[model samples]
Target chain A: MYKLICKDGNAKRGEFTTVHGKIQTPVFMNVGTAAAIKGAVSTMDLQEIGTQVELSNTYHLHVRPGDEVVKKLGGLHKFMVWDKPILTDSGGFQVFSLAGLRKIKEEGVYFNSHIDGKKIFMGPEESMRIQSNLASTIAMAFDECPPHPATREYMEDSVARTTRWLLRCKNEMNRLNTLEDTINKHQMLFGINQGGTYTDIRVEHAKRISELDLDGYALGGLAVGESHSEMYRIIEETVPYLPEAKPTYLMGVGTPANILEAVERGVDFFDCVYPARNGRHGHAYTNHGKMNLLNAKYELDDRPIEEGCGCPVCKNYSRGYIRHLLKAKEMLGLRFLVTHNLYFYNKMMEEIREAIENQNFASYKKKKLEGFAAEQGN
Target chain B: MYKLICKDGNAKRGEFTTVHGKIQTPVFMNVGTAAAIKGAVSTMDLQEIGTQVELSNTYHLHVRPGDEVVKKLGGLHKFMVWDKPILTDSGGFQVFSLAGLRKIKEEGVYFNSHIDGKKIFMGPEESMRIQSNLASTIAMAFDECPPHPATREYMEDSVARTTRWLLRCKNEMNRLNTLEDTINKHQMLFGINQGGTYTDIRVEHAKRISELDLDGYALGGLAVGESHSEMYRIIEETVPYLPEAKPTYLMGVGTPANILEAVERGVDFFDCVYPARNGRHGHAYTNHGKMNLLNAKYELDDRPIEEGCGCPVCKNYSRGYIRHLLKAKEMLGLRFLVTHNLYFYNKMMEEIREAIENQNFASYKKKKLEGFAAEQGN
Candidate 1:
């Protein structure tokens, strides 16, 4: 399913084939957490912005529509009408971060739903079953994402339980694939590596998960309140131990610069909600840096979000018009900025892949990062 | 500027030439009050849904971006990036409906801005000058939209003042259109007729306005707390007095049935916020009737919002999917429904135009109204 096309130092260009479609490596999965981009961006708009894969949340969908309901209606792809590669994260991250805590037993965790505070328990088997019903191209393992600044003892214990959860998740997914009513019978399971910010623990966890021969691997606990240098160092220490044949994903991992740095560290897939979230608050990411639409300088500026951006929004809309919409609390403002930012990220990935193929990724990453860090003009 | 092609009884098929573009008669002008559709629909999306004319509010734009800001950035057509003809209503409606305190005098009206509570005064000349800054294809005259249940004595004085305002609006518009810096040098003026629900007052006002030979005329103060039959009676009584060479407009109106009945009564142009507004609340107008997505019956229904409808939303999305998004408070739900409802309305107008061309408007109106009033099924 995973094919490495070329390598330039540690920056690899590759493609992964899923049942839905083929995804180029060094790709960004547009986040549509509750089956829609938070800022009124539809899947149709996603297509216009060069989106390859859409990432959805297991917790939100399972709680609102229920996995059973989604299964009955077809699947997440059909539900959202996104006929592309879709990766669904295990409810683990949301369960740990959003839900009200109760207890974490050897089997799973018990908590209240963040939406309504209703009692709910999610074990590895339950998580796998929900993903099975969602029937996404990739289903992540139900692993506990330990917070940063954890002691070695807690890290060791969490990593061990995560391993056990991976085994259970893999076993359950295998069973669900053979069921007659399963939406995506070939739904692939990916194991997650969690070690907080401990480099040695991350490397050991990576090696242990690599031994399972899963379809892919993900660094789960980085970017959870850790510094950028710490996250980059951990990725460098851990990635070499993981199998090069499978795709490497960075979970809930960040900024345009962060993606550039991670791709150089051999990570393949990434997703984040910052584009839509920031757009809703009137922030836009241009090649020269981010700018706030609320600033008075943009009130009469007639240029696009980015001068050379090829996105639909930047192609026809002006900064002044979008700024007026934002001031008036119009939804189209959020929609335009969200569409523009996602296009910026996706285009960044496209450029990254081309640079790696031409063996100039190092210079490309440096130049792009510098451009992004530079102050923007009106 | 008006060209009559044919007539099916009172319902005529024709075209009206404007500075921006030619508009098909019996048209439904999509309302973009405050410079945007209520449910995040953009000008690009408007084009895809077969929208011809876009209607904006003078009051909202004047208060927020302000007409001077728009004029500096270019006009409403340039600001919105919509090349089609735009019709901007006089600020009178919003000033009366939304502003805090207002005092009417022979010169003008004084009111506090609903947004910032700042003092503002506007009269016929001020409205025309603002609309000149907007540079829409048609600028409505500044006329009082008298409240429903108004006494005959109040209606008598209001109509006389409105007639005076109409003359001043026409004179101001002529001066602005000839100015060297005017955004649209050929901007046309549209006079409004207002008489509450009194047939005699409405007929007399219509005849008086028709004598001015304005580009278009609108029946204001209808559909404001008045019964459908009473409003229909006023249209039936007053439309004949308006010149056949000019387009007749009905302001802030109505359902599918209301539009159909008014068209047969000789109305040509229409504007309303119902489709976008009702769509935000999950009420959809289908061939059968209204469908509320909030109902649990749509939980497992995989059909489109309206089967056989060619709108973008209906073509690729399902009822179950939209229902899930609505339940989760996702914006895409409102967006999809809004797009569908607008498509339904625009398509209805297209069908109305075609039926008049085919000389079957009366039968078409009957069949459509019955379908819209029927019980919708899954």
Candidate 2:
């Protein structure tokens, strides 16, 4: 259940209650692909960094440790030892992006596994079944994530097929929840809206999925090579069509700036790999933009990654030591940066929610954007 | 100051007071090769894992961050945020083993660095200067680590030259300790005993270095391709010659069984890379021997890595989940295993110390060795 506490312009301050726990929107779900955060972070570390939700990739989990394997171990919560809400993406995006030699049909998509090159078929039912087995708090609908700049005709057919797949996904999820062996009997499904860059198709798809009354709604395929302006415009034009009572997730939607813009346009939930990925590359997110710790300028600087930052990394380590670790190719360097970046994202969301509730989101967003551009020009 | 608290046959229970803190006897110093524990462990994690002393490589630190850089940043303790006692090895071992195109002389060795192939020279004074800059609580004396199977003549010559280097190391450390700008003004030096596998030369070298009245003495160059019995014989012969009242360290010495044997032979300190190295390879150290998490049989095993183990990893994570993470090539898997393994070794040291204090080290060693061999025949 999502309760709209307040709003500042289009920015939303809401609370989402799930079986696991409550999530205060707009929440940035930490991406823990393959059941673990990429840079040696554990669920124990997540709590310390103020993480509310952990997001795992269904495609990766299904590929390596099968969903049945996770089910046998008592679902993802028990498997990862994370008790908070977990949002698992449908295998749709990875099936289109990562898998090789994929064939898309009306029933489903057939693709070779990225890991072992084994043939696998995943339709709405298969995707739903896999998610049901993993039993996350929120399962995304299996929809084709069309690439940006796709033709109107291709996107039209894809969105129609995705809508049909959403219906099948809802029905399958309902059946799985009613089953005796289901790990999470109350597993919720979030329908994703995909229309490439077409506003008409996006709005239409959003309206169409809105009527189906999913537990949540998501705007997908917007950040796939689309310009920032274009993504914002599409979000502004399409968000009004999504139900305000339901949680709105921006699937795979990006950086600190991108999240702030989405939140301004009423996005309530987000999951991205930018923090973890950039951190692995020694980039740290700060209020005043990103700091590349590998820079020689930090070789003798004893200050933390960000001065006055309250993150665990900032509280204990210095830029010089972390720089040396990166130069030495140590894993702790990546872990520290990743932990800090995720905290930066999650903490920004807390500020965003407070700003929205205080009816000062416009000023908060302006200052945050300006701050990101304040140091080293981002 | 080194205080011999008690003795159980050859096993001595003692405590060493350093500028940093007190280190209990039979302690296993966690090796953090490059100043940071590999496997993404930090100083905070070190404290949690019962790590009393941290061991770092002088060669690795000087090669990357440079000793001067650490000095400028307030030494290794502040640099790594570890307040516990740290033991730094001289550049001798790596200069012999890792460096390329090395030249050994009466003064020191000149070689190309393993990292960037840059020419470098390190003598006894240079090693002392580097450790003084690193400011570790305990610094090792520079000595040639002769390979196993060396002829008696070569072993005798190497041991003699090492003794001369030990004298030079002592004088330089004394000068560094008196210097006003030195990071660790009270840095203590531990002389290394090197005589290949020749017990006669080993005992002679141990007797010579023991007369130097250094803070501690380490049995180096053992466990370097020698048979277990041969290494044990060398330790048994040499340790008796070394001062029983001072702390005895076994450098680069190995496994749980190896530690037990060395402790039985009156070794008070040990350091090795097995736990961290094996962990990176998906191997976990347990009381019932080692468990390879990458094995197919652990795919669905939901039990902890070790039953009744109080380490953080085993407290919350299951073997099945850790196996999945390892198979997915996740760093958390390695971190988990490494943490548990270090805790296992450190916890075992605690047990060893208690057993020695209780005057039951013999029976304790028997039961522990039997327990280790009880499962998996490791």
Candidate 3:
């Protein structure tokens, strides 16, 4: 399913094939938590922006329009009208973060739904079943995401519990993928590595998860609240222990600069909500830095968001016009920036992949870092 | 210039040419009050949905971004990135309806901005100047829109003052169009007919304005709180007095059936915010009636809003999906419905024009009224 094509130092270029389509390496998955991107972006717009994959949250889908509802309507791919491959995150992250009164136990975590106060229980088996019903191309194994700044003992215990949970998730996914009623019989699973800034725990967790022979590997809980140097240290320490023949995904790790850094360290897949969320607030990502359209300096500035950016918004609309729309509370303001930001991210990935294939990724990374002066979003 | 193609009874099939583009007769102008459709529908989306002319509000533009800001950025058409013909409403309707602390006189009306409560005055010349800065294909003459229950004496005086304002507007627009830096040198002006509900006063006002040789004439303030019968009665009594060579616009007068009735009474142009505003609230205009998507029964209906509706939304998405988006408070829900409804209205006008050309408008109108059961909007 994963074929490595070339490598420029640690940056490897590969093509991952799924039933839906082939995704290029260094790909950014557009986040559509509820099957529709926030700020009114549609699947059609995603295709126009060169999105190779869509990442949706299992917690959100399971809450509002239940997983069964999506299954009845023919899964997330059909529901969203995107024929591209889809990746579904395990319900663990949102269940831990969003749900109130969450209780942790070996059987499952009992919690109240974030949308309503309805009590719900989700274990490894439950998350696997939901993802099976959602019928995405890639399903993440359910694991508890430990909070940041944990003691070494707590990190050790959490990693151990996550490993046992991964085993259960793997068994449940294998069984669910073969059931006659399963929407996607060939669904792939990728186990997440969690160790909260501990190199030994991360390496041990990565090695144990790689033994399952999953389709991909993901470094989760790194960008949760860790500093850049710590995240880089953990990734550099843990990646060597994993079976890197498979695709490596950096879950929820962000920013244009972050992507460049991760690609250099061999992270293949990424998804973040920054572009869409920041865009709704009138922040635009430009090559110079991040341009906030709400700033009064752009009131009469007729230039596009950037001089040579080829996104449709920048190609047709001026910074002044978009700024006015944002000031006036027009929805197009959100849409224009969202579309442009996504296009910028997607184009950035394409350039990164090209640089990797050409064996010049280091120079590309250096040039990009030199140009971007502003701090990327949290 | 207005070229009368043909007439089937009072429903005429004509074409009106402006410097920007030619608009087909019996056309519906999509209302983009702040240079944007309320539901985040973009100019690109409008083009795909068959929008002929975009009607923007001079008051909203002048208050929010300020018309001077738009001119500096490029003008309404370029700022909004719409290449089609645009018609701007004079800052008169909103001044009376939306502004506070308003005082009326022969020179102009002084009121506080609805947004910031900042003091601002607008007269014939001020309105013309703003419209010129917007550089729309057509501009409306400034006139008072009296309340619904005004006395006959009040109506007569208001009509007389409107005529005096019309002369001033004509003088100002003529001079503004010839200005060296004017974006639209050939900007056309449409004179408005307002006499409350008095048929005699309406006829006299319409006759007086038609003599100005304006590019078009509009019947304003009729739909401002009047009964459907009263508005229809006013259109029937007043349209005959307007010039045959000019396009007669029914400003803000609506409903699918209301439009048919006005077309039969010789009205040729229309603009209203109902389609977009209703769509934002999940009300869909179907051939049968207005269907609200927020109703819970559509949860798993798995059907399009209307069958045999040749809209992009209808062709690609299901009512069930759109309902899910709406229930989840997703903006795509409003966008899909807005695009679908506008396409529906534009398609309806096209069908209306075809029926007029075929000399079967009366039958078409009769059949349509029988089918639509719900009231359009308040």
Per-model TM-score on C-alpha atoms: 0.99, 0.99, 0.98
- Give TM-score, chain B, model 1: 0.99
Candidate 2 stretches with Cα past 4 Å from truth are none
Model 2 in CAPRI terms: which quality?
Answer: high
Q: lDDT tens digits, residues A342-374, model 1?
A: 999999999999999999999998999888888
Q: Chain A vs. true chain A, TM-score per candidate?
A: 0.99, 0.98, 0.97
* TM value for model 1: 0.99
Regarding DockQ, does 1 or 2 come out ahead? 2
Residue A284 of model 2 has an lDDT of: 91
Local error of candidate 1 at A165, Å? 0.7
Candidates sorted by lDDT, descending order? 2, 1, 3
Ranking by DockQ: 2, 1, 3
Q: Residue B341 in candidate 1 has what lDDT?
A: 92
The docking category that best describes candidate 3 is medium
* CA shift of A258, model 3, Å: 1.0
Q: Clashing pairs in model 2?
A: none
Error of 2 at B5 (Å): 1.1
